[model samples]
Target chain A: MTSRSALLVLADGRFPAGGHAHSGGAEAAVRAGRVKDAAGLESFCRGRLHTTGLTSAALAAAAAYGLDPAALDAAADARTPSPALRAVARRLGRQLMRAARATWPSPRLDALAAMYPRGAHQPVVLGTTALAAGLDAEDAAYCVAYETVGGPATAVVRLLGLDPYQATAVLARLVPEMDQVAERAAAAARQGIDALPAASAPLLDLTAEQHAAWPVRLFAS
Target chain B: MDRVSLRATARIVADADGGLPLLVSDGPLALRRTRAAGPYTRVTVVGAMSAPLGGDRLAVETEVRDGARLLVDSAAATLALPGRSAEPAAYDVRITVGEEGVLRWLPEQLVSVQGSDLRMRTVVELAPTARLVLREEQILGRHGEPPGTLVTRLTVRRAGRPLLDQELAFGPGASGGWDGGAVLGGHRATGQLLVVEPGFAEKPVEPRLLGENGAVSPLAGPAALVSVVAPDALAVRRLLDAALAELAPF
Candidate 1:
């Protein structure tokens, strides 16, 4: 079980995982008119959590439980099609690794740091990083779920110019769904990646590509 | 879609008089085939953003048997045409590669045209020793403009438990499916996803990151699952290279 304090920290938006730097595609979604105010943002977040979140949570569990981090990492890499976004994962990964190591401090973290010297995606690194930090499989799964949606929700506040309260309301409403997603992910984590696979939507795929070439950068991607 | 069994609508007949099927026959999503052994059917698959309707949906599901292999291409760079009714275009695709079956599901970028509403579900189940290669491309916005609003959902499940389930609600803020750095980097314009199973040229499976374009995660196994989401084919190609390199390894 993950301590409530640890869960709070893991769930915190200011934990320095470099999550703030990413709009979770919110900027691009806004640019595309796919996401507007908090309501629209919620829908986008829900879609992502349902599809992409489900996959990432499973992979994070794979990393937490000691599955081949490399294999799960590879799968996560494959699932993310946007080159710009992928670059963001590696960069955020490097940043999070730096942060996790400093906050937790451990040899296993050292091993992962050595594995991907440049950086690992937040999911892959988070799975193991949470384990190293003493978060359980369930907690790790929750972390992945929260991070997946929260990043964009935060971005929604900035991109849509909605009231922070509105953003918080939307996120709060998604809690039940997030719990369901985490539960499903936790279940898959027990089975391993072979027993589990991921599927993602295609428009998001193209959006990443389009966002990648944007001359001006709002988010890392 | 438990309400629907992928097998109920099986075997796409190519011709009469003991001929192959227009679409491949699939059993529980895996590969299957029955050949009178003649010239097989060929179909081109291009990009599509919204769910296909009428003949277009049929085009999306058209298949050729083992005795059949399609050189898939696109029709005017597929677009996600908006729907007139509330129902999104539903695509149910089943492919069976018996002994030596080959079906290529490839297409150009799928552009989600403005005011397009779509829903596509592909239930593919491959046998233990089956071989397959499928490519799915989807793009948002028409001519660089985000298509007004729509709901495009994609779900692919194998052997029961769930492989991929995606729902893209583009209308008001009512849909909740995909978001996060894990997928589109929180942007919206265009995105494409590609996945392939085992059976490619032999290589030392060492999955490595190729260009600074993105990161690569190397899979260690006989099966390879690759996905590249990009705004255009070029970016998808870059992602494909990194993914292939990672999946095939050195």
Candidate 2:
């Protein structure tokens, strides 16, 4: 049997909030000759968990562990140099805050919402929401880790190139890294987002650039 | 009483003799090329059609056969003529990507000038194990022009699960005027993009430089979709078409 709390966390599509609309750049990668199929997807997801997912996980843990909302926001923003990434972080954060506040009420969450006008990022908002929900710091880390990779998998399946099983398998393979990233992300949260290290992936960025020019497209930036 | 409609349909046959792209590996980059500017190759419409000058609602559809690649490009910047609320203009694009087939459906940008009510929708369906690369961009108001209220809805799905869907409604400063941070962010230009990587959803690839006035996010999965609403529709369209060609033969 699953805990009602945890069930709501995963079962609700809104929990991921506008995640359905994003490809995590899967479309871009497949289009660019990088990711081909299940094998390629697995390789890509693992890499993300190690790099971007790792960074995002840390930020999420920090948010859960009670990091300064302003500091976390700036840190996540600065670390994600790509304007597209930055926009995504904020867009997810802003919308998440709106929904979290409505569903799970908390004063701390309110304080975080106030911070958005000042440019708060999604991970930080997510962290505050986790804290309000009484979730442990680890939960935040895991959620971020899972989300960073999970999003693209869903998008790919929706795009009709991979089976649901193949995408889930990719997630399952990342479990080990998910554990490792949880630890590292939690530990890094102590040092703050600025001190955190990041390995930027270039292929994703190129695909995003290419996708931005279509006359008739399916996603919103 | 005057009414207008423009429809474009194209079919691509792979191995149509060796051609550009120099890549012939199960790639059928069949395309319908329409001249939009000076000294460019042009394809005539098979039948029923009318000149598209913005404001006029335009509809487009493209299909790729299994093991084929379809590439579609346009001639010039699509301008939306200003119209009253009761007589707004619209444009529609429908597409299908078959199994092991590739479709790079990239066209020019849509420029929405002042007093123009433009409605556009794009629907895409992908087969099981199919692949596609697409691009799209929109300019709210062109050349520092004031952008009044705008409406647009876009949808993409595979096996009937929504991958990306967007709905935007705004008027010249919907967020309490242009200076409001709630809207525009004072950037004057906006864009949405999709990069479809079928297998790798959360894969983090490096962001690419698309040129000035453009930005790229990290790679997400096997398929990525983006919406880029920018300042000058012309500049964005020019950038997108060139990029899609390089992403070919399929």
Candidate 3:
């Protein structure tokens, strides 16, 4: 059986994967006036959960399912159209590779680090890390799906000085939908890498590129 | 249910005078070769009848051989209207650019009317040295009504490698949150411009924000992609037109 604690460790906000530096486009949305208060954050998070969130979860699950990492990496590149977002994924992947290798000491993670050097996509690395941690595809999916929204929620509180309770409550209300999204992602991974979701969030993509050009910003992406 | 099936093909090869050597069109898609100032060959797609309603299958294929430059555009915007049949309409566009060849595909907008469902896919194959400038504009709904259902997938490959492949869905029946804060954000008009140039291999374009609603960034390959979302078709075109002029690297 997989270690349940490993799953929590992977999903914890304090995983030290360099995720805190990025707001997953939340910083840009706030500047655009698209997300202001707790309610606005919930709407923004919901939109992200279904589009890029679902797509990232599926990739993580496929990686955990033992799909070819190189192929999954290419697929991740295809699914992400914005160059700014692509850079962010690779940066996070590199960081996660370091932590996962030290914690789990797996040959698979070592080989992946050698192959990418810089890093593979974060979702792909997350999946391999899940494997090293003795977790399953569903666990990996849950970790990624939650992070997809969790990163932004945590950042929004700091960016707007919103109530921490309100932010936690927003995530609480989305538990049911997040669970469904995670389940769907894991099931799709069983089909194959080609079966992964390619949903696009145009506004997020646009805002990310816009955010990358910002001279002053709170988050990396 | 009976559905209309139309398959159109256009072929072009370099001629002695840099003209079109072979051009073909069939079905409701009539290809009209128009004269332009440049040495490149230009063609316009003139719709012979109202088409692409529900249960309809339409395909357009174009090939630009080596040493040839071709430009293609449509006469007017294509409307996706509800039909008697419940099945969704399908439109497939395939384009191939040979070595050192160039292609410019600037089709008109595709409007998704209420109660209609349409699925469109565009696939492009380019040789290592080939160049391409393609634009896609989509309007979710008319003036006051809500959009129906529209789904589009674009797969572009350069030298047998994926450059950009994405799928977008809008209106009813799409996954939840498409119109929410992070997705469209209640915008009804959206589009993208993709320009692949060999020049970018030496020096990639810097990421830049276009006006307020759009942005341009370099892809992994020797190309650039500009994405835009606006409140109306006019605004979308304005941003995309400006982007195309600034970013199109021949």
- Please give the lDDT score at residue B56 for candidate 2: 53
Scoring each candidate complex against the real one, what DockQ results? 0.16, 0.05, 0.69
| After superposition, candidate 2 runs with Cα above 4 Å error | A1-16, A193-195, B1-250
| Fraction of native contacts (fnat) of each candidate | 0.20, 0.05, 0.73
Report the lDDT tens digits of candidate 1 across residue range B143-225: 56755444444433333323334444443322345443333543443332334344533542333333423333222323334
The candidate, 1 or 3, that scores higher on lDDT is: 3
Give the DockQ-based CAPRI class for model 1. Answer: incorrect
User: Which segments of candidate 3 are over 4 A away from where they belong?
Assistant: B1-27
Better of 2 and 3 by lDDT: 3
Docking class of 2: incorrect
Query: What C-alpha lDDT values do all the predictions have?
Result: 0.58, 0.57, 0.87
Kindly provide the TM-score obtained by chain B of candidate 2 when compared with the true chain B. Answer: 0.65
Q: What is the TM-score of each candidate against the true structure?
A: 0.60, 0.46, 0.92
lDDT of 3 by residue, A1-221 (tens): 78889998888888888998999889998888888999889888988998889999999999999999998898888778788899999999999999899888899999999999999999999999999999999999999889988999999999999899999999998898899999999999999976787877999888888888889988999
Stronger candidate by DockQ (1 vs 3): 3
